[model samples]
Target: MNLNLRNAVISNVSGNTQAQLEDTIVDAIQSGEEKMLPGLGVLFEVIWQNADRKDKQEMLETLENGLKK
Candidate 1:
């Protein structure tokens, strides 16, 4: 069977509110499970695709700072 993980992940959270989305992300991070990575990657892909140059730059900078910790 072929599974489109990105589509599946996006569909699962399609209409979630901001607080709900935050809870989903926070819960996944707190769980620290490998299975959650794909979903997070899908979410990040959506963010990256929609981000403006300035937003992308800020994200990269924030990610760089996060890596320094």
Candidate 2:
């Protein structure tokens, strides 16, 4: 089944810390949960919007590697 990525992401990620959320994202990806993948985009947008440049870059890289596996 297809999922609304942005909305689902926003809802699931409401209270988690960055590290916690990253772990969750990695887990989701490893499990081949397609519904959870797009939510990473939302997480990326949120972190990019709010984080310092260094943090954003680091997170983005980590996310990219996570998604690729």
Candidate number achieving the greatest lDDT relative to the actual structure: 1
Candidate 1 residue lDDT tens string, 1-69? 115887788899999999999999999999999989888988999999999999999999999999999
Misplaced by over 4 Å in model 1 are 1-3
Tens digit of per-residue lDDT, candidate 2, span 1-69? 225767777887789897988798788778887766676667767768989989978988997999999
lDDT of prediction 2: 0.78
Residue 41 of model 1, lDDT score: 85
Supply every candidate's count of residue pairs whose N, Cα or C atoms clash at under 3 angstroms: 0, 0
- Taken over the whole model, the C-alpha lDDT of each candidate is 0.92, 0.78
Instruction: Tell me which residue pairs clash in candidate 2.
Output: none
Scored by TM-score, the top model is 1
